[model samples]
Target: MAVSNQEQTPVEAEERGARARTARLMLDTAVQLMQGGIVPSVSDVAEAAGVSRATAYRYFPSQAALVQAVVDEALGPILDWKSASVEATERVGDLLSSSLPRIDAFEATFRAALKLSLDQWAQRQAGTQGSEPQFTRGHRIDLLRDAVAPLRGRIPEAGLDRLGKALSLLFGIEALIVIKDIWGGSAEEAREVVLWAANALMAAAEAEADKS
Candidate 1:
């Protein structure tokens, strides 16, 4: 019997969906092992993901490759910030503040990314840069400025500088360690710190503007 075009499309779509699910499951297992300090092996991950060693190996050829892909997928939300235009710089802070909730939501993923980045850096023979994408810090700063731009008159130079520093430091490795590893705060707490800091800066900016 000949398959109709309509039936073929659904079959193709199902295949795509199944592949996506399998890929995601593999990624999730890798992340879980990473989080647990297990240094996930292919066999371990395969078992966790409920797939055969052959299937797991087919999907991820090596530990580094699997780690790279999982970390990339995990950081997708933050790295893909939608910058409408260069004019976005003016309101970077606001846009960044809006992402505070999202930041909290993905704290585990973020924590795992920090570890992966460090591992990559260590492999660079101690002086070279890490394997992680460079956009993390730069993008965060860019978005911060964009969110704060509309309140420029309200935000003093010192205040803006402080805000930038906070975003770079608190929102990066430092905060990842402090909140996730040391303090053991939930994702919500991590995000709240960022949001509160941003809002405080905005409030201070507003106060300064009022004095003018």
Candidate 2:
């Protein structure tokens, strides 16, 4: 039984890859559970992943960590869309159109994440660091900027703030909740409504710029 450092390197790499794969699998399961209305707990996820509870805890030390991981895992495509739209479009309308479809695909996850947003805001207002989603407002603002870049010339500098507010109000989780929970739209319909509203806002901004 001889163990050499040289021979251990490949084995270590394999172990690392396996751990990464396992972590990813656990995250995937958590997302699916969330989508399925399961409200997945660490123990539930560990059971689903066939890992020990301690192993799950090692990867995600808290419920917030697990929830954030699910949110991040689901946003991969949205990030890609932002990157692509940032590169391809020269007009705001086109960029909005490009981004909306990606946003549509991930609307449910966004809605789920938004469920606690207002409570978090209230806590922050009260001077407590509340449990917020993994993503930050700055990240969302960056995404908004990316979606608006194509309209830079057409949307006046002064109007950018208004446009940002309009888009943020119309396209986010609260909007989804209003559509689904308050307004009684299905998830699919709510996404379509948000996309339509986003497109309309972009088009209106363009038209106003053209008039001026």
Candidate 3:
């Protein structure tokens, strides 16, 4: 019998649903393990998810692939975040106020991703990293640009770029770790620190634009 090309048979539909469930299980397991602050291999996630190595490997081809899925999970709402306020400073503040908490909540997972990226960097430097997919970072750049987007006409392009760079240092897990672990501040304090600095940078950029 010639099967319809567009429609899945009952068996095919069941297999697709089963595959999706298995992928979700492995990804959930990966996120749970990453919460403890270490990036787990595909095999590790498979074991923890009660899945066999072959099945896990079939779902996720490598450690990088697993981490990528978990990173997307960790990023979730933060990636789609946008500010309703029209004010540049207010937008920046809104972005920080909303995102910092999420970053802190997923601090362990972000740190794990950072560590893996650093490892890949070191391996590449030593000419030892072979055939491994590099873990990607730098979501902050676009987010910052979007946050300060209201200043495009008011500030020079370079000033806006500089502001984004300065803000990046005070954002994300790096900033959270500094404010929480090093400065020993509370989450509220971390938010305060980022807001103050972000506001100050916004002011400085506008001030520079005035001079321009």
Q: What is the TM-score of each predicted model, taking all chains together? A: 0.53, 0.68, 0.91
Task: Name the lDDT of candidate 2.
Answer: 0.67
RMSD of each: 6.5, 4.8, 1.9
| Per-residue lDDT of model 1, residues 1-212, tens digit only | 78776666676889989988998899888877765655566688999999999989888876666766655665567666655543323345445555555555555655565665566567665655544333222455765555555555555778766766655665554564677678888656776675566567656666766786
By lDDT, the better pick of 2 and 3 is 3
Q: What lDDT tens digits, residue by residue, belong to model 3 across residues 1-212? A: 77798889899999999999998999898999999987899889888999999999998898888898898898888889888878888888888888887888888999999899989999999999899888888888898899989888787787788889999998888887788789999878888888888888888887876776
Weakest lDDT window of 10 consecutive positions for candidate 2: 86-95
State the lDDT of candidate 2 residue by residue for 77-186, as single tens digits. Answer: 55554444442123344544455555556666655556544445676788785454433333456667776776677667778768877877764456656887788887
- Candidate number with greatest lDDT: 3
* lDDT (0 to 1) per candidate: 0.63, 0.67, 0.87
